[model samples]
Target: MRLKRNPTARYPETGEKRTVSDEKKRGGAFALAQRLGRSLMLPIATLPAAGLAMWHTARLSRRRTTGALMISVALTAFLTGITEPLEYAFAYEAFPLYAVHAILTGTSLALVNALGIKDGFAFSAGGIDYLINLGKSAELSGGYLAGPVLLAGIGLAYGVVYYLLFRFLIVLLGFKTPGRDEDESDLDTFEFAAAAAVAADRSKQKVVHSHRRA
Candidate 1:
């Protein structure tokens, strides 16, 4: 009896016909997943701090109309890490600003870590846990009061950086961000042409009726 071999088997690296030893190498999916997962750590590390900063800023900057409402909205984002709704509103419309946000978030994490202030929560790095830990136990809280100062600076820096960079990039690259590309004249021209055509048709119809009457 002879042993059978799989014709479809291919080398992982070269995509050539696979031999028995090819099984020693890892599959493409596994390799790609590992690489991509490692790359995600930087962004994931920043989310908690970013959520906290946004929540705190909204809470402190309340107005008569939107004060309480904005605070509640920011709190939800802080606790849940569900920023997609807010992010989607401006991410594509102002991509450079979004990129600055990501950079500032990473900076916030770095500043907190460097200050020897360590804090972690099982759920999320939201205000609830942050406040709870503040009074719970100094040993556990890791003296996170320093966090607010760092976050304040990060928020201010983020605003200035985002504004300046967004303006520069928009002018330099000519990106079609939300308000930059609309042409009201084009629509006005179309409307004018349509109205003129309608008037001409009506006049032609009136001439035909008068001639028939005559």
Candidate 2:
């Protein structure tokens, strides 16, 4: 009679007895999916906010260029919720534009606070505080009138300051603010591809090692 052997004892690569575990592989897939989801959500959520900002900026336009820039900044802020990017965009033209934007943002916030206007939804750091405070104070002040007045004040301040200061800053300084961010760099898709390839190679090596040990 021939001797019989256990079939499960042999590994696929090394032909030795060992067990295989898929847990790590599954975990990696889950992590990757989560990261991708978050990345996509970030840009998606801000687009609406930026779009609304653009509309508001356009409405306040006395001329063309400054209005366009404000709209762009609003869009950028809404989309990324980051003012630095928008600030840096204007840094090259008229150093005073930076000061102008800062003053306008502060003045708008103050007027919003003083008049008690509430923002329906906040998309960026720029105006979110003013709206929130306005909402809270509106609630505390008994009714609708106080909030509307404050909101009007905010609108007025934003329009006037943005118009006057932007014009002055552009005319005088001719752009170029300090600490401004430079234009965005290229995406470099190759780096991501290389990283992925390296990870795949590592995983393959791991799988091979495990089999050999088995």
Candidate 3:
């Protein structure tokens, strides 16, 4: 006689339905994405202020190294929205810290927007546009005093809040950010080597082609 298989029977190793733990992990990932998306608003919202802050910080720094660093940070943030590199480095490992970043970003945006401060640019928001706008007219550009004050406050709040919240979350969650995961480290190293090899090969080919033309 043929035996009938049970429809509800699950393999010992693989369960048919997702467990609570699995569901939580999925939820965490979604939450991280949501927070990261929200965090973007902060950078985009503070483009003009961020550019001004960079310029002011660079001017205030007595040391060349400090000024260079400040300028680089400002330019990168303004031009390309490259905040993701640093943000993702922290976000992938310490999701809670990223969440804090998102909250702070939203708060800063709200505060600035509430003050009726608005900046427009044809290209990416950054130092170039900020300076351009400033050159145009101080009064026309939402006045001088309120814009600077709001920017300063937002900058200070971002720095302090991010530091405190990141530290607290890291300690509390024991997050495994970059350099904390063995497997991830190995993978990164391999990928880097592979990319380098490909770049080197391309360079060599270019040199050979140039010699052939010559």
Question: Which candidate wins on TM-score?
Answer: 3
Q: What is the lDDT of residue 10 in candidate 1?
A: 35
Least lDDT summed over 10 consecutive residues: which range in candidate 2?
Answer: 34-43
How accurate locally, in lDDT, is each candidate? 0.39, 0.37, 0.42
- Model 2 C-alpha lDDT per residue in residues 61-163, reported as the tens digit of each score: 2224333444554554444334443344344444455565555455544544454333322222234333443443345334556553444444544455455
Comparison by lDDT, 1 against 3, better one = 3
TM-score of each prediction: 0.38, 0.36, 0.47
Worst 10 residues of 3 by lDDT: 12-21
lDDT of 1 by residue, 1-214 (tens): 9866433333333332122112243343223222212212222323333323333332122222122322333444455433443343236655765787677656655654444443333223344444443432233223334433333345455545544555566557665432234442335334433543454355446634543442
Task: Please identify model 3 stretches exceeding 4 Å from their true place.
Answer: 1-75, 182-214
The full ranking of all candidates by lDDT, starting with the best, is 3, 1, 2
Off by over 4 Å in 1: 1-73, 140-214
Shift of residue 14 alpha carbon in model 3, Å: 52
CA RMSD per model (angstroms):
21.7, 20.1, 18.3
Q: 44 in model 1: Cα distance from truth in Å?
A: 16
